[model samples]
Target: MIKVAVILTGVLLLAAYLVLLERKLLGRFQARIGPNRAGIFGLLQPVSDGIKLLTKEDVIPQGAHRRIFLFAPAVVAATALLTFAVVPMGPDLHLGGRKIPMVVTDMNVGLLYVFAMASLSVYGVVLGGWASDSKYAMLGSIRGAAQMISYELALGLSIVPVVMLAGSLSLVDIVDAQAGRPFILVQPLAFVIFFLSAMAESKRIPFDLPEAEAELGSGYHTEYSGMRFGMFFLGEYVQMQVLGALTAVFFLGGWRGPFLPAPLWLLVKIVLVVTAMIWIRATLPRFRYDQLMGLGWKFLIPAALINIVITGFVMVGI
Candidate 1:
């Protein structure tokens, strides 16, 4: 219970600050200033933003399905937080002759658990859009549903080689398999597929068709307000961090570094991955819907499948 509380608190705080980090980075990318008024260098901007959201009016559209509308954002936030339960941050602590694993629950099927959570998160968008009773919201949700489902195939397939190499679905086991060397070295293609698929899974930048402001008017959560809206906002950032951590676990040698503590190494890897994500956002325009779907279905999926076959053949030969 203590571990769960600590993890949740840490995730929320990190997610809040990540927004600030993205803004700061984006400001630099665009040659402008980010939030600089709330505190020293806008360090406290997230706090103020949190306060404002908490104090603001929680408004539901008149025609909205009150129950589903109210519940949707929580779905998004909760799933993202729950994903951390199985993510091992470092080596287990040995205290008072007792072993405490770094992860909340080191399930044998942790990878499957992660995908289940990702699948569940889609419901939040679907429910929010459907309950809002707005055409734009519905369209956005439909797009999100299609996009997520399409990319999820590639996302799952991309990791097949890793699973084959590691011979386990457990993330901890996968990390252990990479002790001699990171998977990125041997499975660059899978890493690329996973990286691109993860970006799409997180609905970042080029894959952000669902929330295309010009087309969808704030997308699935168009009718949300106050902390309800904040929940959805928080979910996106948390998912970003989760995906970053997964990337680290799968390819970057989770927590393994020469001079840093294990946890710090993991954190550094995650931040690097996240920074690249933000940079991609700054540089790439959103993909057209057809183009997005085509890439996921036609390209990433087939590539992942072929990579898996090649990996299988190599393993057999060895």
Candidate 2:
């Protein structure tokens, strides 16, 4: 119970600040100042934003399905948070002669659990958009769902090689397998594919066709406002953090580094992965819808398949 509370609080706080961090980085990338008004360097900006969202008027569009519209955003936020349950941030700690694992729950099928939660988040987008009774919202949700589903295939495929090499689905076991060297060194191709696919799955820029402002009018959340909309926003950043953490767990040797506490090492790696993603968001343009689907199906999927085959051969040969 204590572990769950700590993880939930930590993840929610991180998600809130991640928005500020992205804004600051983006301002710099654009050669301008970011949020420096709310507090010293806008340190309290997320707090102000939270207050505003909470106090703002929550609206339900006329003719909308009120229950589903209200419920959908929670689905996204909940699934994203739940996915963290199996993510081990550091090695076990011995306290009072009791062994405490770093993760909330280290399921043997941790990888699959993560994927299942990710897959469930799509329903929030679809249901929210559909319940809104807005054509724009419906279109955005459809595009978002299709894009997420398409990229998921590549994302799932990209990790097969990692599982083959690790010979276990448990994330802790995967980390243990990498003690000699990170998988990024051995499965470079899988790493690249997984990274790209993850960005797409998270609906980051260049893969953000679903939320294209000019086209979708703010996309699936077009009809959302106040704290309701905030939940949807929270889900995106949280998903980014979740994917960043997964990337570290799979490729960077989770929590493993010399001269640092294990959890701090994992935090450092997650920040690096997330910063790179923000850079990509600032540097790249949204892809044309066809191009987005094409890259996932024609390129990433095929590359992942080939990588899996090669990994299998290497494992058998050695």
Candidate 3:
């Protein structure tokens, strides 16, 4: 219980600051200053943002389904946080003659648990859009559901090679399997597929068709206000953090590096991955809807399948 509480609080706080960090980095990428007035270098910007959201009027559209509208945001935020419960942050620690694993839970099917939570998040987006009774929101929700479902295939397939190599579904076991060297070196193609699918799953950058501002007026959350809208916003950043951690664990060898504490090494790898994401966001233009679907179905899916076949053959022969 105590461990869960600590991790929950820490993740929430990290989600808030991640927004500030992205804004700062995006500003740098665009050659402009980001938020700096809220606190030194905008260090306290998230605090101010939180206060503003909390104080804002909570409004609901008259035609909206009040119950579902209110429930949607909570679903997104809760699922995003819950997905981290099984993520192993570092190797077990020996304390008081006992070993303590650095995770909220150590389920054998941790990877499946993560994917299941991810699948559920789409319902939040769909409900929020449908409950609003707004055409734009409905369209956004449809796009979101379709896009996520399409990319999820690629995402899951991309990880098959890693699971094959590690011979376990538990994230801790997967990390341990990489102790000699990270999976990125052995499964570069799978890593690329996973990274790209992860970006799409998080609804970032080129894959952000669901929330395209020019097309959908902020997409599924168009009718949300105050902290309700804040929950959706918070969910996105938290999901990004989750992806970064997963990438670190699966490809970068979570918490495994020389000359540094395991947790710190994990943190460093996460930051590097997040930075790359930010850079990609700055460089790429959003994909057209058809283009997005085509890439997922035609390119990423086939590539992942072929990679898996080759990996299986090689492993079998070896």
How accurate locally is residue 144 in candidate 3, as Cα lDDT from 0 to 100? 96
The digit string of per-residue lDDT tens for model 2 on 163-258 reads: 988999999999999999999999999999999999998889988887899998989999999999999999999999899999999999999999
User: Roughly what TM-score does model 3 have, to 2 decimal places?
Assistant: 0.98
* lDDT of model 3, residue 145: 98
Question: What is the C-alpha lDDT profile of model 3 across 248-315, one tens digit per residue?
Answer: 99999998999999878877887788888988999999999999999999999999999999999999
lDDT of each: 0.93, 0.93, 0.93
Estimate, for each residue in 1-318, the C-alpha lDDT of model 1 and write its tens digit: 999998888888889999999999999999999899998999999999999999999999999999999999999999999999988889889999999898899889999999999999999999999999999999989999999999999999999899999999998999999999999999999999999999998899989998999998999988889999999999999999999999999999998889889888988898899999999999999899989999999999999999999999999999
Error of 2 at 167 (Å): 0.7
RMSD of candidate 2 to the true fold?
A: 0.7
Error of 3 at 109 (Å): 0.8
Report the Cα lDDT for candidate 3. 0.93
lDDT of 2 at 8: 88
Off by over 4 Å in 2: none
Q: Report the Cα lDDT for candidate 1.
A: 0.93
